[model samples]
Target: MKPFVKWAGGKTRLLKEIEQRLPADFDEWENVAYVGPFVGGGAVLCHMLEHHNNITRVIINDINDVLIEAYRFIQDDPGPIISGLKEMESIYNALSNEEQKQMYYTSRKTFNDMDGIDCQKIILFLFLNQTCFNGLYRENTKGEFNVPHGKYKNHRILNESNLWEIHDALQTVDILQGNFETVGRRLLREHVFFYLDPPYRPIVEKGNMFTMYDRTGFNDSHQERLKEMCDYIDRRGWHFMLSNSDSRSSDGQSYFDNLYNGYIINRIEVTRFINTYNATQRRPKEVLITNYQPPQQ
Candidate 1:
């Protein structure tokens, strides 16, 4: 099972490196407590649920309301979402080329204008994703979905098989919508592990112009706050693994290296599948900071 919803900073390509660096006992330990503070597309969560049989409890939280509820509805009920997508697909395909372009913008406006969360809003959310450029989800300062329509030969808006698989994978998962700081509030001390994939700290100064998973931007302060949490996690004797950009700040020094200097910070060459400028250009360095150093591979 894989994540159906594609979001920015997803770790689909780095899953292997991430798995190897995990605590050695992760796969064997039973009755474990797992927490995902910034579950974007749940790439790690999906891997753990399918591969790690010992996890007893899982708590997945994200500040994005639409993303969190999408998980909830997918796990609890996906029939309505799928049916709505089918209707949308039919309506979109029946239009002429020009009509389709108009329809795409119209749908985007309706998606942004939606009020009061319902299955329909969720449906539009998925629809916009399918038709949006590069499947990218971006929003403006007004908390509106503003990504332009994408031109694709053929798109699959509804994937019943994958949705069902994702639904099954999330049956025992606890989904929450809130800040990342509150994630570890009620979590137990021992036998708990946290995998944090927060918004990437921009490499270039003021380079985070379009990093809008949420309108509430994650800036340097949030990065510092996350560092403090890592310190706390170590002091509390809990295990944690974090992924962030390895871009050097304007000072020509690795910012993440300084932030996570005390911990086991390992830099790995990563491939970016979705390139901002060009998809073909995708070689970059990403830092994986862990509290515990697993056995060498």
Candidate 2:
């Protein structure tokens, strides 16, 4: 099952690399729990639940309330969400290209001003993601949906079957919203698997530095906090993996090498940017850090 909406920094392209590098004990354990602290796009979460029979419980948490709300609406009941999508599709398809663009900005404006990702409003969130420029989620400093309208051909707005599949797969998933620390409370004695994909730190100083995905900022201090969480999780004997930028900082220093010392770090060449459509900003490499060794064939 695919994600309900297209997300920035989504792991859709890297799922295969991630699956091959999962902890060795995953197959050995009869009933394992899979957890993702920053489930942007949820490509990995869907993959794990769909492909692995050993996974009994899946806990997917993210800081974005709108994204989480989309997940919950899909999981609990996609009818309203689906209905909303159909309405948007009908209205969008009936209009001229110029009118569609006009409606797009108006819809975006309505979405950004709202405080919560309410049931009615969440569908517009999905619509904007589908029709916005390059399908990327970019908000301004004031938290407005600022991306221009995307002129894509024959976009599938309301995919009913896929949504149903996602809903069924989410039956085992517990969607939590808050800081990454929220998942710490759900830890247990069972053999647990952690896939932590926090927002990637900028490789170069002049980079856009996606300090804030929503309203709050995730800076170097947040990265440090993530490292600390990894340490605590590692000490607790939970198997874990993380993804981040592999580039050197502006000072020509390796950022993740020292942060994830004593851990296995593999560089994967990625053709797409972690969170953007800017061709100039697309870095070639990404760091995949793991605490446990994968069983080799």
How many residue pairs clash in each candidate at the backbone level? 0, 0
- Candidate 1, residue 140: CA error in Å? 0.8
lDDT of each candidate versus the true structure: 0.82, 0.81
* Cα RMSD (angstroms) for every candidate in the order listed: 2.0, 2.0
Tell me the deviation in Å of residue 247 in model 1.
2.5
Which candidate has the top score in TM-score?
A: 1
lDDT over C-alpha atoms for residue 171 of model 1: 88
Total residue pair clashes for candidate 1 = 0
The runs of at least 3 residues in candidate 2 whose Cα sits more than 4 Å from the true structure, single-residue gaps closed, are: 273-283, 295-297
TM-score of each: 0.94, 0.93
For model 2, residues 27-128, the per-residue Cα lDDT tens digits are 888778888989888888888888889888788888877889889988899999999999889888888888889999899888988886688788998899
